[model samples]
Target: MLHIWGRLSSINVRKVVWAAQEVGVAFERTDAGASFGVVNTPQYLQLNPNAMVPVLQDGALTLWESNTIVRYLCARYAPGRLYPEPLAERFNTERWMDWQQTALNPAGRHAFLQLIRTPVELRQPELIRQSNDETEHLLAILDAQLGQHAFVAGAQFSMADIPVACELHRWFGLPQARLPHRHIERWYQTLRERQASQGVLDLVLS
Candidate 1:
């Protein structure tokens, strides 16, 4: 049996859940992180020293890091579907997943923190603006790519689409003026139609 630990609101956790659903993994999830804090517990620490959410326990083995967990789940279970083959395709998938963690997520965090998590009086306008601009610029790059390919990595919905789409869901959920991004809008609409993305991507932003 597979066990996943994390609150559903977490984007990282959402990535694992979405992938698990996609691959038809029978798993149980325990809410942790944010208000429901199990992260610092001794047992939890044994699973993930970083005290992060979405720790995966597979029998004797425990794994953390959302993207790696996604890769592992897909590779172990749905190799030909979610986990792609071919050298070029594999690296293309890996590249976009890395880009989401390094570029898009950070750029979008400010707006999420201020608009959703932080109180109005505590929000930082300049920081929000700067991050929003960066997020738009980065997403514009994604939009350009989506204009060519149906999905992030290519025509098929691979592991690459999971993380970045989850991040994009967050960006779209924020209440603000958005730069018109037709490709992103179209891609995200298709993502919403997927059974796996039903609860994961369509949920209200945290």
Candidate 2:
């Protein structure tokens, strides 16, 4: 059995859980990180020196990094469905997965931390504005891509969609500036309908 360590509320952890569900993988999840507090334990640190949530243990294989875990799960279990069969198609999907970590996540983190995590009196208005602006720009890019295709990589939903979809919940849930991307909104609606997403991603932002 695969063992996952992370708190359910964590976005990184949620990505792994969502991916596991997408591939119909049966696994055990142990609460850790944030309020749950197992991430800092000596045992947990040995598994992931970075002390991050979502360390996956599958028999002899131990994996860190949430996106890497997603890829591994799909590759080992779901294969052609979640990982994609063709080399070109897999890379195309992989690009967006990397893009989430490189681009969307940084911007989303800034905005989410400013608006949700930080106290209003202590919040940095200038930084908040900059973060919001950058997120909007990134979402606009996604809006354009979503317009051309049904999912991020194309019509079929793959592991690539999991990370960004978690981020999208934050973007749409927060009481911030309204986005003008009809296609992206439509895509989000579709994700909302998923049984796994409904249980995992459908929650009030913390």
Instruction: Give the candidate number with the greatest TM-score.
Output: 1
lDDT of 2: 0.87
Q: Which parts of model 1 have CA positions greater than 4 angstroms off?
A: none
Model 2: what TM-score? 0.96
Candidate 1: residue pairs that collide: none
Model 1 TM-score is 0.98
Kindly list the per-residue Cα lDDT of model 2 for residues 5-63, writing each as its tens digit.
Answer: 99877888888988888778788999998888878889999999999989999999899
- Name the runs in model 2 displaced over 4 angstroms: none
Largest lDDT belongs to which candidate? 1
